[model samples]
Target: MKRRPRRSVPALLTALVLLAGCVLVTVVTVQLILGERPWISYDAVAATLHDLHWTDLLPAVAGGVLALLGLVLLLAAVLPGAATVLPLDGLFDSGAARGGYRSTLRAAAAGVDGVSAARVKLRTRRVKVRVETSRTQPDGLTDAVRAAVTDRLDRIGPATRPAVAVRVRAPRRTS
Candidate 1:
């Protein structure tokens, strides 16, 4: 039940920046082709660059800020996200299912004979079921819980068949 991670914000920002740059370049090129002076004057730009000081704190700060922004975007794009919802298949309309399947599997395990309570964790590739038993041996309880879980899974017909693991624990007797 793990959904794929995504970094949509960084991608969107990059697309917007590229689009703005393209539009600016296209506008400047069109103005030059029509023999009209664009807003940008090369002489003024060259003069500004010539007078720029290498020790300017503003440019250094701006470069540092840009570098930090790039690092953040890179991390956003690279980091893996925690996903709990998964898309279910094998139906006419695709739909998303969350992790509530654990409850259903737990109930199925609890229904087994000699099981008092059950806990289930359903993952993308595996299903883990734990049961508390007072009268049943751990080995027999594990087998029973595993069979019930298997039957439940077969009935539900999930898109993917993950391996199932069952554990039985003896409940502590009250003094």
Candidate 2:
């Protein structure tokens, strides 16, 4: 079965950060021009801002808010189908798993007879797996890597073979 790529939660979060920044900028500019303080006294806000010399706070505030929002997005990434949270942890997990599987396959490729180098990418039913090699990859290298990954994943935990993709790499010193 063809697997659908997970949505980019970080991208969404970044958009939100931009939105919040716009809101913040508008709020500050409006407050400065209109002499209205929604959260505190206008005179007090004016006095504190003027005396504290905290004009640089705009970026700080924006950064702080973005950081908090990032944390929330990360949490959502961990938990699937989070209404308020985006599943970003899963993305990292998929990447790590794919990397691990690729490395293992590469080692297997090295051991395979007539194989110069191996690049493997594996995607399990759980996440993403992709591996690429620039070294001399001989014929049947793809099959060899696939067999290796299947065997390893089977030994370790439950995973799907179809989700994993083993791409044959180009041979080094191509004429």
Candidate 3:
């Protein structure tokens, strides 16, 4: 299915933070220039900031956490947004097809011997496949599923090849 990516959400969040920062800076600048006591008393804020001591574990930790959050926000703002959907080679039109490959991976895993059913979760950098079977011998089922999934992924040719992990569940009762 074709769907638009939500890259703007983070950008919007970053913009809101920047806007808030600009408002703060403008208020502070105005306060300094015009000598006005406004919404938040700058004097009290300055006193609290200057009095922050290393010995005060709570405040120190809080400051550190806030700094870390700011750093994360900065990185997110600078970094390119993640690709939401994996693009596939188009059959009829260029850039018309996109896939997460969940069904393809699941089918590939289920095709392996002793894999009665399979569940696949495909992500940008990782593919997780889980298989269930009633067969007693599951010695090589894991390796088999892994190989099948890897082969299928190679054929699909995603921009970044994801690591494949295969998990086999216990055999079900034959009743």
Candidate 4:
């Protein structure tokens, strides 16, 4: 079973459109039943519809716009969003949040002797580790941080272990 995050924006918009249409229909129905003039003028709408021709540029442009909007809504509903969690290598369905992995890897990189600060970015197939250090000649700091992060990933045991890329940045001199 593949785990993927789904967006609610499209669904919410569709629901709101349907709700507005229903409310408008209900109000018109109630007004007609009470023998009162509806907010929308039926005569004007009928005249407008009667005047509009299928070959007219306005009607063609309106139809094209509506078709494009419908296509966009359909695509949004069908496509899957980004994954919030990474699946683990287990028999049962299990996963770990990306934030947890990032924090854990950050701690692991920061625990190294020369690393002063560490920032980890967890991507689909790569883990980027950027470390900041005060030492002028931070020679082996990048390797140390990379090993630490790799060890942490091994401990976490994700289904597909992402490649660890480490970058070390020296503290800037504020002269």
Q: Each model's number of backbone clashes?
A: 0, 10, 0, 0
Which residue pairs collide, candidate 4? none
Ranking of predictions according to lDDT: 4, 1, 3, 2
* Model 2 bad stretches (over 4 Å): 1-46, 50-105, 119-137, 154-162, 172-175
Instruction: Estimate candidate 4's RMSD in Å.
Output: 2.9
Q: After superposition, how far is residue 21 of candidate 1 from its true place, in Å?
A: 28
Those runs of model 4 whose alpha carbons end farther than 4 Å from true positions after fitting are: 53-61, 113-117, 132-138, 169-175
Instruction: Please give, for residues 1-175, the per-residue lDDT of candidate 3 as tens digits.
Output: 2344655766788789899999988987887789776667778989987888778887878989989988887776676554555655535322222344677778889999788899987655788888998877688889989999999977877655789988899665566
lDDT per residue for candidate 4 within 96-125, as digits (tens), equals: 886787899999999999889989887778
**lDDT value, candidate 4, whole model:** 0.87
CA deviation > 4 Å runs, candidate 1: 1-83, 171-175
- Model 1: per-residue Cα lDDT over 67-124, one tens digit each: 9999998888777764555545575544344456677788899999888888888666
What TM-score would every model get versus the actual structure? Answer: 0.51, 0.36, 0.50, 0.78
lDDT for 51 (candidate 1): 85
Model 3: per-residue Cα lDDT at residue 45: 86
In candidate 2, the residue pairs with backbone N, CA or C atoms under 3 Å apart (3 or more residues apart, or in different chains) clash, namely 76-86, 77-86, 77-87, 77-88, 77-89, 120-131, 121-130, 121-131, 122-129, 123-164
Evaluation by TM-score, superior candidate among 2 and 3: 3
